[model samples]
Every structure is written in C-alpha cells, then in structure tokens.
Target: MRLFLLLFAAVFLPAMGSSKAVCHADVPCTLGDRSYHVRAPDDWDAATPMPVLLHFHGWGRQGDLIVNHGRIAGHTRNRGVLLLAPNGLGRSWDFWRAGSRDTDFALAVIEDAAKRYPIDRSRIYVSGYSYGSAMAWRFACEGGDGVAALLAISGTIPQDETCASHPRDIRHVHGLADPVLEYPFGPGGDPRGAVRLWRDTLGCGAGETAPDYAIRPFLTLSRTVWDSCAAGGRVTLDTHPGGHFIPHGWIGWQLDQLAGRAPRYP
Candidate 1:
C-alpha cells in the first residue's frame, strides 16, 4: 500500500521543471538566503499586462511542494497570470512576530515578479492555506494598499489591532469538520471570527441569512457573501462539511472574480 501511494504521488505530482519549461522558463529569484519560484502563462507575451498571484504554502511545506502538489499551476494554466510561490523562512511563516522578514520577503517576491513580467499592478493578489493563510491575512492587514484581493483556505486571520484602512476584496474557505483548523475555531483558531473581523473592518452591512445558493455535486459546500461594503470591499465565506482542504474548482472561480467575470459557479 505504501509503495502504491508512492507510485501515485510520483505519477500525479507535477514536476517543477515541467511547469517552468511550459512558460518559456521558470525564473528563480533569491532574497537574502531564501528563494522563490515564478512562472508565467505559456501563451503570455508583453503585449498586455498580466495579473499576478502570490501563493504561500502551509506549515512544513515549501515552494516546490506547492508547485508540485498544490495544483495551483495546473489551475492557472493558460489563464494569463504570473504565479509566484515563495518559501517561508522555515516550515512556517512568522505571521505574528513583529519585525519579521516574512512580510518583506513577500513584498520582494512581488516586486521581483513585476520586474520580470508585465504585471497588472491593480490586480496583484495573495493566497495561501493553513499557516500561509495567516500570512495572507497579515499581508492584507499591513500591506492592503498593494493587494487587490485575498483568498485564504483552512486558516484564520491573525488577531492584529492594526490593519490597512483601504478596503479590499477578501474570501475565506473553511470546513466545519476540519481537524486541523475547525470551523468557527478549531485547535488553531476561529476562521469565522476572521470573517466577521473583515466584515466590520470593511464596514459591510448585514449579509445574506443563508448561503446564496448551493453548487451541484458539492453538497458539502455553501457560500455567504457580503457585497454591501464600504470602499468597494467585498467579503465572502465558503463553508464545507469536511476537514482542512480546498476544493479543486475554487482557484478558477477566484480567478474569474479577479478578472471581473461573473462567478461561473454558486
């Protein structure tokens, strides 16, 4: 059984070099002692500015692991976006530590990608899972001015008193049965409280009583949205019946939202 699982991972996991080769070549950027990976769409040209996505991995994970197993590159393929995945200092990002270099590393990754690709400054976005999600929220709080949107999965926002004044689009996904990070508050923390925090910060009015609607085939999933917000902010929460995991369709849906396209799913 262990051998079979190994074979499965070997066959299914994407090769880091393969994705880099697809986009002409993968660009490796080093900041201090850490390095990050950057890949552009295969069909990209300098004719138009492309959107950028900065994805951070969960605890005990690195950029190569996400590039290989996270399915981020596969989802964004042909989507005309530059994808950047950065490694944390160790197994986790120092989200709560003041004077931490993680935030600076994130910003440096973005600036480096912009220098290499024609990135749409207004469409720069950040996303992550687990510990990385906390970093995403941290970025939204301290560096919201540079981020247009934030997508977090299986994690809660940090309890920070100071946050960016400008409103930005925010979306969170959490599972009620998440053994790692429970629904409202698991052993890690409460992701729903993070949602409420953003709602108040963005000045969002009362949201829908229930999910807007359910998506077919995913009975475990439901969504709540707060559209009436100040400073053009919008907040959304997606709940699921299972544990800490992100749906395969979420990346495409989020990309559509960033591109100003109507959601393809409920």
Candidate 2:
C-alpha cells in the first residue's frame, strides 16, 4: 500500500508542482497491474476535468518509445490535459482476435484515469498511428458512443460488423500514397473502402466535396464532413499525400474540434 501511494505521488505530485513530463520508461499507470509509458502536462488535475487523449502507436513501436517521440505530449501540453500512450501486450493491439480482451483493458484505463485525474467524460478522445489506427476504428465502431471522438492516422478501419453500427464520432486520416492501404479500395476490400464505410455510416452525401487546403511536402491535408448524422453528430476525414506517418497538425485540429474551438486553416 505504501509503494502504491508513493507511485501515485510520483505521478500526482509533479503535476501539482506545475511541471510537464513526457515519460519514455515503464511506469505504474492507471491500470494497476499493468504499467505503460505516458506523456502529459504536469498540471494534470483530477479536480479540474480536462480532455484526455489516448494515443495508440503503430505496430512495432513500444508505448514508452511512442512517448519518447514526443508527438502526443507536444499536442496536449498547451491545452492542459492528459495524453496517455498505453503499451499493447506484445507491442501489438489485438482487435481482430478473440481472447485478447484489449478493449476491456482500454476501458479500464479510462475508468482508472478518471479516478486519478480530473477527466471530462464527454471529452475523451482516441487516436492511433498505424495498426493502432485500425484498432481505434474498431473500438469506436464497437463502443464509440462513450468517447467524444476518434482520430485514425495512417491506417484503415477493418471490415467487420462493428462499422455497421454507424459510430458517430470518427475522423480518418490516410496518406494518398500509402503503399500499405492503397486508396480507392472497393468491392474486394481496401483501406480507402474502409474510410468510405465510416463516411457512409456518418451519413455523408456521396456527392460531398473535400475542403481545399495548402499542400505540404509529401503531404496534403484535406477535410470533409458528413451531414445530418442520426446521432446529431458528424464524421470528418483528413487525407494527406505522404507515406505511412502521422500527419502534422492533424491531432491538434481534432483536439480543437473536441474542445469546441473552430478550426483555422494553415
């Protein structure tokens, strides 16, 4: 019990001290028996109720390594919230197979984090890099209503009964030149088709056009929205022109939308 309190203090005290930290080593996380590397602003408070960003890294990247990359931490620091990067068992998220029970584990993390820090239940967001992106889509489709939003990067949603439920809060990001999940996948199953599935689920019109935005080196960001969703919510998509990588500023934009802040074009 004393060791647990000390661990809690190790986490709680730094935030109380107004310090920010991005951890790259195994540490006791909200999931008690499990420890994952996490990054966040030191000001995290359980009493202040802030938005939480649960970022799942791509295949082969450890949670601690993801934290070390500093992408998730850098995005949420200015907003004064928590950014958690939970390590997948074996460094891979098990979304397609049974007995994995990873979803329940993630849910536990959510409940645990809420108990440790001030979390706005209505503002919980999930994101992923690659394979993690696929898992994010799977979770959102299966149990998305509980979360405020989902941001999928560099991966496509898997074909499953989950998407049939028409999850309302989802934003897919993919590279136009991604060799892994090529664009415009149809009939036979393709990554682009997966996006179309979520797009259709969100009730977007087939004729809807994408927004115009400036192009980046090896990447171009495009946004589109579905109209008149049944849940009174909408779905958005951001397409880029690069390979398999988390597009810059995509996370920040989602956070802004979650925070009720209007988006600004770069």
Candidate 3:
C-alpha cells in the first residue's frame, strides 16, 4: 500500500502542478495604471498560433464576474485559445470621450498577450456585454481592421460622430427586452441601427431574416443575416427575448463559429 501510494503521489503531484501552471487566473498585465485579468489554455503552444477572444463586461460588473458568469473560461478550456477579461475603470467602459484611450488600452492588452502567447493576429476577436457592447463597437469602428471578428452583446453602438472609421467585420447580439440598453438606447442608435450602418458600409445585402430558438426561460430569439462583406466575411444580428443577458444558444453558436464550424442560428 505504501509503495502504491508513493508512486501515485509522484505522478499526480507533477500533473497537478502542471495544471496550475496552465489554467491559472489573474496573470496580471498592465494598461496604463490598470491591471487586468487574463487567462489562457493549458495546452498553449507557441508553434501553433491560436485565436484570441477578449470579453468586456458591462457596467456594475468586474472582470472576475464577467469571466465566471459568462462561462467564457470554461468554453475555451479545451479549445486551445486565450480568453482575456479586462477590468474597465470602475466596471464601466468609457465610450463617450475620444481622449479617454479605452481603445488604446484594449489594443495594449492584445499586445501584452502576444508577448507571452502565440496570438493569431488575424483571428483576434473582441466582444462585450451592455455598456461594454458600446465600447466594442466603438473600438471596432475606430480600429477593427486588426481583428478578424467582433461580437457585441446586450448593448448599443456608441452615439458619436467618431463612428466615421469605415465599418469593419462585426456581429451583434442583443435582447429586445433589455430595459437598461433597449433597442434604441442612445442617439447613436440601437444594435439594429448599428448593424444597419454596417450593412451599408460593407455593401452587404439587407439581410435574410430568421427565427431564433429560446434557450432559456423568458427568452425568444431571432437572427438576421447581412452577407458578403468586403473580404467575403459575414455579419449577423441576433436578438434574444429576455433582459440584459446572453442566451446559452447564442453563445454556443459563437463558440462554434470560433471553432471553424458553421454557426446555426437559434
């Protein structure tokens, strides 16, 4: 029994240590005075550049809650990728000010991630919930060319003239019943309005309409398609039935898209 126990400890302890080395949390990085939370896959390899997914939280939420509540870390565990959840100043993303430098901070986070991990520059994705969604669109409109895709959840686009940066590839997800950030939250327009702007900017069709499946209680869903981006990319607008939360199916479909699988509308 002693020999068996000793052998097990020798093998299991090293494995446990290695696991901690891989899925560890907070792994601090700086953007000005701010220190943000970032995580990566345990099996990350430098030779195989992996796609990156950055999640921004809404107002009144921190990075840790965003990471846990959104289940982003869990989704990426077996996917061989990096998931960055940066803490915004006071749990809010600043979109109203041009000189605030939130966009620069986002890019800085990406650059920081690249220094430690193999990041596929062409496949970097940015997403956010609620107010963070507005920031996501603002960042994309200002400097989305560096990323491969964009996902905005339960939020509206920034209502600023700076939206003038030629539209890039982006996908929007929102809840029609979102009281905090409704269909037309700001003068900048709602998720639908922002998507429409992109449809025109990208020269895509008006979009094919489809029904979305209910994945949760108090949820109805719908999706619209704006096809044929400038680079053969695609844009999607997904609406959910509930409040300011992402639907399980919507997130799953996004995961599928990231995995190079055909995304099914639900």
C-alpha local distance difference test of each model: 0.70, 0.65, 0.66
Candidate 2 to truth, TM: 0.79
lDDT by residue (tens digit), candidate 2, 133-178: 8777766766667877888887765443435343447778777788
Sorted by lDDT (best first), the order is 1, 3, 2
Error of 1 at 262 (Å): 4.6
TM-score per model over all chains: 0.80, 0.79, 0.78
> Candidate 1 on 54-162: residue-level lDDT in tens?
8888999877666544357765555777778898876789877445568788988787666555679888888889888878777777676878888888876544355
Candidate RMSDs in order: 7.8, 5.9, 5.9
Q: In model 1, where do residues sit more than 4 Å from their true spots?
A: 1-27, 97-99, 165-167, 185-192, 209-219, 262-266
Candidate 1 lDDT for residue 241: 77
Where model 3 places Cα greater than 4 Å from the true spot, the runs are 1-24, 42-47, 97-100, 158-168, 185-194, 214-220, 229-232, 262-266
Which 10-residue window of candidate 3 scores lowest in summed lDDT?
13-22
